[model samples]
Target chain A: MSKEKKKPILPMIIFGIVSLGSYFVLFNQEGLVTETYTKGGWYAAFPILTAFWFSFVHGSFGSNLLDVVGLQAKKNK
Target chain B: MRKVAAVLIVILMILPMATAVFAGGPPPKNLKKGIFLEVNEAAGTALFQDSTTQETSTLMIGYSVKAEDLKLNKKMMVSFEEHDGQVFIKTAEVMFLDLTLTKFISLIVVGLVGGLLSGFIGSGGAFVLTPAMMSLGVPGAIAVASNMCHKFPKALVGSIKRYKYGQVDIKLGLVMAVSAIAGVQIGIKIQKVVLDAWGNAGSNLYVSVVFVVVLVIVGGYVLRDAFKLSKNPAAADTQSKLSLRLQKINLPPMMHFKTAGVTMSAWITLPIGLATGMLAATIAVGGFIGVPGMIYVCGASAIVASATELVVAFVMGTYGSIQWAVSGLVDIRMTLLILSASLIGVQLGAIGTTYVKDYTIKLVMAATMLVVAVSRGAKIPVYLQDLDWATLSPTTTAVLNGISFWALIAALATAGIIITGAMIKGMREAKQEVQVEESHSKA
Candidate 1:
């Protein structure tokens, strides 16, 4: 039980850093990002792809962060 | 292999239809996103630099636009009307608001609560988040677009989590989504007819009336079913009588949905999906009808219904976001900000489901629907007054508006409290059970 309870601290830290880095890059390049993203053709894929990318990276970071903090679903019978 | 191919073929067929139909409805007409460089109130014109092309164009402001409303260097979305081959700005407003500390915090807070509710109920956030953003001074079109942009990712995360828990029925979700796309087209046509015939006020009245009627009827039924299930635990997982009767019909093209554990004819399932889509186009929250329809009409359990609704949300939201994005309506900054907190909230809510019974989901959903009904109900009189069908004093209008807004907040707050409380109780019970098992092993 003790071994099973080990927290996922390392993965959480790595994902947290990567997620924050991605956010910083996007925010810093807002002008170029907004311009390229809204061009109304193939450029439409930009927002959808970006959303998926963030959901994967940031979403993993969030899930790991919760597990590290000891929030998890109870094992079903 | 055959089943997989069939599903893929269906999705491929529906994709183009969805794009063509839903494309023309939302984000208003001839709208352009740009930054306001100069507002020359004296000349009734403004110099706007297009965000996409960086081209500066002087636009003639319509009579209703106040010079004070135009802020320099702020992102703006302007709607244009072509009169005598000259384009004039019919409406112009700031697209993205300044992200001050207070507004930032408020958005994150609402995102978290809205995310939690969505995770629990399968469809939420848009009903409240769009209004919340509009109240913060974001243009209505941008708010809807940004909200849609955030929705798909959030739904994607929640659906994947629930899928892992064996709650989602992918086949059912896809079938429903395909039919829903068609329904949205019809719903949009109805909306356009109303808007053209009676204008914005009539449109608002139509939406409010539909909102109240649907919420009251469906929410009351769900609440009653939830109460009955709570009273008799043995009947908690039983299919509704309506669903059982529908399933008995030997209609052609019967589909088996394994996760939902239901086998029903295509004829029955498709109508529910279509209605869900129609309601979604009208109210911007299709899950209100979709989840209930799945449970009571399609013989799905509440858990499966809610989880499947997430799948439908993912499909529709992704499609809608792309439409809005191409039109340059989505404010990515706002979308990402909401996603930042909602991702966390959604994961937590998804986990919360493991600890509670199926009735709990129905209860939360019903409670939310009823409260939201009150919120929209409060706006009906205001809309009627706008159409000159009813007269309302300024103070009365103000009070009704306040009730409408606060009722939305109340709905969010109530769901949050119920989810959190139930999760804590569930976790405690599980911990105690684990402790008891440990003691038994020692003995």
Candidate 2:
């Protein structure tokens, strides 16, 4: 099922960089990002936006982390 | 091909019919819909107008409030009188719309960790998210709504990953999800009634009691089973006698599940799903019982049972999110924030399953269940005090609350460590095997 292709490493590296960058932007400076999220109502937009942002970025990081560590699910078909 | 088409048709038909049947109740006639105009204490009436119908109505809001404290001009919500009766302002809570950057960061951090935990355990981290949101000044209903909104997508992602690994039983999951949704509706009704009659403190006490009792009993049984299997790994493969007997019951309308490799009466499966849904509504930990019930009672292996639970969670979560969204209570931020980490966490957990023996899942599940039981159990005394049944010292109350919160953190940490350790070991072994095969091919 793998088709013997060369394992792609760049996607994993790009994901890592972006994930860390987002984390820094959100967490730096007296928790401004978190404070804005809890202000309620329309401020809730902050949390929703960040969540999607992290899901793509961190999700890719995790997926590739598994790949780099040689932990893919067995291809039984 | 005919059989496949027949199955698809049955699914399509049942999906709508089941929804219509479950949605049988009439809409709340006394549901007050309006924005508050003024609070008049002398007449004890809160002036409100229906936003949709554009009808002005003076609603005798059931609860008492001070006249001067009413906020005007902001969109305030109100509920109704008898069927086709006058609408009254129920409780006009303020809707604020300012968020600092700090809350955004916290949601991501919490969401990532929560997602990671959910990915690993199949259930958890949500209990903390709801409370965390509430602590961050979100209302109780909104916290739950936001959390529910996030859950379905996370479960969907997790279920797909596990399905790829040959772990999910789609047929079993659908059956369970359908029944579970019914259970949730009933559970919600019961909860609403309790809250109305007994008030918040009483409702909280009741929830704690159920959480403590169910978790302890279920957790104990699972722990015992895990220990037994650890002592004799071969025993994991053996079918339980009860399940063996259940398989023999030649009842009509029997259903077959390929991944689960079992065919049983629809009647048998429905109750399990119902219980899962009801418990989910009550405690938000449906997977805790759902997975074990499928394994021990329904006789599927832990791998398939736990994986199938993701599908059930997805279906239920989506329904719940829509309901919450309709009310505009779902804080999309909280939902997506949790999804961020949880999506990844679930994938990792699904893959982790491939490396461990069936008994290992049991061990992790039992350990989590038991520890979480302790967390809930610690809160019982606090609830009892709230009910005024017992008088406790302030220090003792504080200590118990601390223990309850910390225990939850401990449970997550322990589960995370164990799952990561097991996955690492499995990955190493798999790589060694791959290397061996490559060298052999070269030779």
Candidate 3:
């Protein structure tokens, strides 16, 4: 119970904020993002690279959120 | 030896079909990637700038495509046919879809469940997501492209999670993935031949039929095995006799996968990978065939087979996404929206596996595959009607479409229920055991 109480809220919040920020930026600039992304050449990298960014940032936030909620894998030992 | 011979015979069989396609088939339809430069409403013609060559050509827009709907300067994918020295556009789809509130929520919901399914069973979502997005009014190519763009990263996250639990075999996954790419080429070739002969409706019918047949046979076998394994938990970790026999074969270039604990001839794995790729190209669900082939043919246990398949999915998804993105077909907005939920779902699913037995994974997969088969089966009549082979009233067509779409929803719902139920039950049992051990040690 004490260990549960000690779980960090700070990093989770930080990650959550950044994840939300990234999504906001993309949506807010939807027109530019779409135009640049669909340029059909070197611009193709924009979407692929952006996907990688969200996966890492948002993925980390998800990990922390799950941990805070007490869901975890069983230890073999 | 006979099993190996049978696999060889199957490949040989596919060769003739490939040759037959090449020898005498209707001209393949031209699916070009380009942007609309100018739309002349009066002539029902549009000037298109080809994405690849930067060449501008005039295309006659079919009556089905409204001129008002054409968006100039937007990247588009056009399906056309060359007739008597002129290009005729059958369909022109703007690659990027408008992200509406309804579409946004739907992508997240589907992404989360699909991710969970993929994480738990090793293969899922593609069969359901593409159709689900299409139902939400996204064009078929955009839906497929965006779903694929989201898949590789989800697979990467899921595979990494499973790998931490000592479930993945990179060597095995890489071997299968490389061979599978070759299979994709052949599958694409076959699809082109079908498209040339019967056009869009025919192509859809071909895909649906293959989807139904493959899912029924493979899913049925896995379900029966799941039942057997559940009845006798002690045998859950045992390898099939086929794997044992194949391991004994003295073929050269034997590759031993440490995590899967299998050592077999390299020759044996290639055919399975190729078959998986072919299935993937034809149906857009390679993982469906890949995981099962790994288990039944390569002799890997279900747990290892499913986990290794994540590696294959990651590789194939990345490769496929690049191909789509290069043509500017990927709707990044949709891809990100889905990933927003799926990344989380995938990780949760990966952890859930640690609580349950291998049979649980097989059971979830079997359930998903069987229900998904029903979903595709319901669409067969609709496609038949489109081909004019069968006449149906408008109401019947609407009813069939409803059945097809709802059946997909049902498959997702069923799989979600079973996976969550199994995970909860398993997690509760694990916690109780941990508490008991802690108390005993303290006392």
Candidate 4:
């Protein structure tokens, strides 16, 4: 039941930027991350939270990108 | 009233199973997680600090351990054994893996294809990804842990997409997931038993045998059923006789799943969940069995069953991730790298499913399963070589390993092709139909 968005390109670019930025930050601080994230115990939430954040930002971007490319689900028949 | 009762009963059944399993804690493996506080090569000993207890121990350097590789003040996971009343370090690994360009690209590629398969069929990618990571020099536990960490998110994104298509059955998926969680415990326990009994080679051989046997049987049956359904479209919507008979049973606590459109006793779904959990624990992919079980045993259509599987995957993956996380083994960089591509692949696959028929899902799943069976089957002889049960030439072992890795690639590639082809064809036909309708209306 996902209706076609009027202009997915704009939102796609925005999300793409955010997702890429997130990755950039993650890679930029690799040593700090690799240390803290793998510390076990309550530090488990770090990875879980990161996974959710990317899935939302990156996931939406992927959905819209697919829409822009005309690779969409069949309209409700 | 009955539905609530049935669900509660199911939960009651699951709680005890989970507690019983969790109570056992992880098998008493000699592996410990901590940091190397100091090393004295001349003394043939190292002072190690336990992360949890803040206690230090003097561990003797075993013959297999490379003393030079031990860095002071670095967090690590190591397995040690008692050799002649002295605790000896066996293999020590740095907690985090060094991800090079090669490792990054490979993770992304596998994640994309694995995501596509998961979005379309609701389960896949773990089986090959774990081994693929190991090949890239990741520790076995870390590879499995990182792969699991990625799986939940991918499944979350995928399930949402599929749910939008109204294909996912929340109640049924939850029912299966709760039990599947318990089953993972048993699976881990069984794995521990195997490892303790026969070591790595024996474990690999056990996993490979189970992988090949299950895939051949389930995949073969699904493929056959797909052919039958494709030829006879009228039978597509009907539940299997097994499902129908099971549904007819006048059992107490019969739960009605609206999305799946069948009412069945809660008891029936538990075994499937347990089996799925056990297989997932053994082979790293439960969707191979989960989807088929939902279809044939629970009487859901392929579309619904596959979509619902994402829910199960999400729950199980999250649970698995937490377990790995508590052990601090999840490699987030590898997880995110895979997600970088897989998140896209999953959505694309989810939409692709909307453009195709149910049979296409089955066909793709069957093909992947059979090829994956080949991938694991090829590794059997090499595992045999390791166990000293069979002496394989070096060339033979190398060739077999090559075939095994490539065959996994083949499985994903085959599924990707089928899904893409079907979606494209479906889109073309839909567009053509729209154009025809527009023309007729204008006239």
Best by DockQ: 1
Query: How accurate locally is residue B128 in candidate 2, as Cα lDDT from 0 to 100?
Result: 72
- For candidate 2, what is the DockQ-based docking class? incorrect
Error of 1 at B344 (Å): 1.0
* Candidate 1 structure quality by residue, lDDT tens digits, B46-140: 88898777899898875556677677886677777776787777777876566888888888999999999898889887899988998998888
What tens digits encode model 2's per-residue C-alpha lDDT throughout B409-442? 7777777777888778877877788778778887
Error of 3 at A51 (Å): 1.4
Winning candidate number (TM-score)? 1
Ranking by lDDT: 1, 4, 3, 2
Report the lDDT tens digits of candidate 4 across residue range B157-237.
Answer: 999999988999988888888877777788888988998999989998998899899999999999999999899988898
lDDT of each: 0.87, 0.70, 0.82, 0.85
Q: Quote model 1's TM-score.
A: 0.95
Q: lDDT at B160 for candidate 3?
A: 90
Per-residue lDDT, model 2, residue B282, is 76
TM-score of every model? 0.95, 0.77, 0.89, 0.91
Residue-level lDDT tens digits of model 4 in A1-77: 13345868999999999999999999999978877787777999998888889989999999889889888788886
**Per-candidate chain B TM:** 0.95, 0.82, 0.87, 0.91
Candidate 2 chain B worst ten-residue window by lDDT = B20-29
